[model samples]
Target: MFIQKKYIINPHFMYMAGQFDRNAKLCTIVTELNRTFIVDKSPLEILNDSIRCIGFDLRGAMETAKFLLGNKYMCPIMVNPIHKICVFPDKSSIHNDVKWFNPVHIARTFSSNQQAMIEFTNGLIITVPMKLYSFNHKLQTADQFRKMMLSIEQDPFSFEKDPRKGA
Candidate 1:
């Protein structure tokens, strides 16, 4: 059984959820942020069964949408789908690609700081503050999250009994 989980992902940072299809080994992430020009969507199927990394230019989300429409790919069901494009320029030099990795190999950095890092099995690391993670039940601090994830590293099925009570 797949246990659904919810995460806040930070107030400013967009809420992103990734869905992976093991048979095809593909991942599709749908994200929603406060950026003016960005449109939030549900998981995209076009992004699946593709390469390890899929890059996107927010400025071109419209174009991407058109491409998906033309190809008969379903449009993602977004929470707040309508928004203005950001007028402020993005200066980050990072490529906007959605990379897929096995969840079993994912690990987190042990830190007391507000920010936390998740190291993927492929060695790709993404950092977000601890407050971003939302819980359906009890909350966990950054330190506690580190410990919980560490325990999972030791036994992946440890949480099978009760996912709400982290190992």
Candidate 2:
């Protein structure tokens, strides 16, 4: 029987609890099971931390901090510029099911479709839907994508959302 290597680590799982750095060519993924894995970035020179290049739901740092602060939670949050990823402090007691996979991969999209594909080092191909975040399937180079990701800033929320908006 030929056993195909299935992904123990999915994209959504990586998004919530992991970080990526294109310059360094690394992705640090944390599984829900509280396991940490560092992988390489290759083939996917077209994929980086660009909002326009790939589909993602991201919370800007300032916005995240405001909400977290309002909740009276004391924790350290930092952004690794080199990695272009937001790093939040992990509380040991919190358990999750996150895992790791080979980071070296290729990302491509069809000119006529709003979807993309990510091919992993293990030859596993993942189809990435691009319309969720309103990305129109525009082709973006690694540098362009990095620039966009770096340029994103969290807009300040109004009093309606944060009671202590100014305070």
Candidate 3:
């Protein structure tokens, strides 16, 4: 007889809380494991600060996400050539009439990750597993993944931020 252990991890309420907070003014990305980066912020400062703090270029991430999402908008990812960073308002907070892109593509891409979770600009949570690239089954009860994400989000220096200033 084979015993399959059930993995149960609680979702991080802080992420959900931050998503609903309209006055949040900062965002940060912390790497918990080898290739995972957890995005957390007040939804106001996430776009800009994540680029500054995380080594991965925001332009690349945005372009990747945009391309993956199949956004019809031709707007370049970076408005400022020098800064190479885009600071647009969180799309999730906008009214339905203002939304121009489909998040299904983005969500699908996230669902393809080997082990990943993406908190969209609109507060949607997407969780992906390593073996999911071939099998696209959506795992709704991912407690360990949520716990790992929350752990990284709460720790500022998990990704190597300055310990003195406190990220």
Model 3, range 18-99, lDDT digits (tens) per residue? Answer: 2222345332222211222323343323334444454555557456435432442322233222232222211233322111
Q: Poorest 10 consecutive residues of model 1 by lDDT? A: 84-93
**Runs off by more than 4 Å, candidate 3:** 1-41, 57-60, 72-167
* Every model's TM-score: 0.23, 0.25, 0.23
- Give residue 122's lDDT in candidate 3 (0 to 100): 41
lDDT tens digits, residue span 86-128, model 2: 3222221122212212121223323235554544333444444
Model 1, residue 31: what's the lDDT? 34
Candidate 1 regions with alpha-carbon error over 4 angstroms: 1-41, 44-102, 131-167
TM-score of 3: 0.23
Best of the candidates, TM-score: 2
Candidate 2's C-alpha runs over 4 A off are 1-79, 86-106, 111-115, 120-122, 129-145, 148-167
Global lDDT for candidate 2?
0.31
In model 3, how large is the Cα lDDT of residue 13? 16
Q: On residues 12-75, what C-alpha lDDT tens digit does candidate 1 reach at each position? A: 2332333445444333353323221221222233222111122333325434333422322222
